[model samples]
Target: MKRLRYIALGVMVALLAWGYVAFNHWQREMIFMPSRAVGHTPPNGSFSDQWIDAPAAGGVEGGKVHAWWLPAASPEAPALLYLHGNADTLSTNVAAIDRLRQAGFAVLAIDYRGFGASAALLPEERSAYADARAAWQRLEQLAPRAVKRLAYGHSLGGAIAVELAATTPRVDGVVVEGSFTSVVDVAKSTEFDWMPLSLVVSQRFASDEKVAALKTPKLFIHCARDEVIPLRFGDRLYEQAGEPKSRLVIPGGDHNDCPAAAAGEWRDTLRRFGGISA
Candidate 1:
């Protein structure tokens, strides 16, 4: 009976380990969803394809991330590093980029590794930050003549933007739209609230903790109709942010429609924060 008991105990341990691994994998899938392919095309003479070097991460070999460069008519116009959300590719946020261009800021929007035609690596929080930094380096070279540089991120990308603003030496401003305080908090507020996500969730962006320390100017925008992350998260981030900050809650639109539905507000934001005006 003693030998049988030992075997049962070892089997239970193995099964528990397997269960944890499976749960962790599922969490990552839910968080970092890379697109299957390059699904959309830019208009002729609208934007140019720009590729930035990405160092190896998460065991994936180093490769390049694809980007769309939309330069303003003036080389000295303010620039923005467009870090898109976890589920988005550059093609998905074309309207937002167009609005930024209209506001007179050169834009560089990129697809993180494992998304679009860039690379085939698995997406993770750390890898996304690495990708953004690499893109920032490219933007520095591409827009060196610009008067200033800003970082704009939507949803999960907002968390990455906050991080970039806090860590980088060249960022002039930061804009995070419809983003959450932390991925773990958002998950807890969802149906998965029942799950112990803190233990399995390794991709916690934790923007709230970082936003408070940034001295650079920031704009936190949210939509009243946003059901994905809720307006509460944006409010919390703004409240936690230090001085030289502002918040805009668009009366209409959802998580991703503010650029279209609240076009005037977006342009105004660019003008005030980035010194760009149409």
Candidate 2:
């Protein structure tokens, strides 16, 4: 009986140690689900080919990140630097880009280091932020005289957008949709509620802290029916943000279809915030 007890104790310790290492190693994959195969190109040749120089830390060697720029109907129209969610490429956001285009804003959307046709490598939060900065620089060079420039992000991209808006001096406004306050808060709200995520998780895309520091005009959009990220997260972020902030709640909007659910309201709010003429 004593021998059997010792073996069981050894096995349990080994398993626990393995579990800890494995969880830490793969936590970023669980957070960012990059899909390379399901990407789509821009429609009708309306977009131009744009690329940003890769970050020095990128796993891929000597590669340029891909982006698409769809100019608005007029050259003097306001512009949007759109950062997409974690799972897919910029092509996955074609519809949203189209919506913004129709609302009279030039749209510049990029594929982060790992997603789409940019490069084949795992992306970290810091590298992703670097990619956003590079894209913003390219956008500035491409459209130096844009009437107004806004940073717009959805889901994980919302956190990225908040960071850019807070840090970048030229960004005029910010828009976030279906975004969370922080990765730690999101983990707490999900199945890993019991885990000490703040200690274990490596990525800290804390939008709440960044938004609180921002003084630009802000707009938050959330779907009440969003299952992936609760609407309260968006509300909490809005609360933390400084004044000149607005929010639009789509009553029946899910995580993916909020703009479609409230199309008119979505376009109108963006236009008003961006100061785009009718």
lDDT of each: 0.85, 0.85
Per-prediction TM-score:
0.92, 0.89
lDDT by residue (65-108, candidate 1, tens digit) is 99999988989999899888877788787777777887888999
Best by lDDT: 1
Model 1 error, position 45 (Å): 1.1
Q: How good is model 1 by TM-score? A: 0.92
User: How many residue pairs clash in each candidate at the backbone level?
Assistant: 0, 0
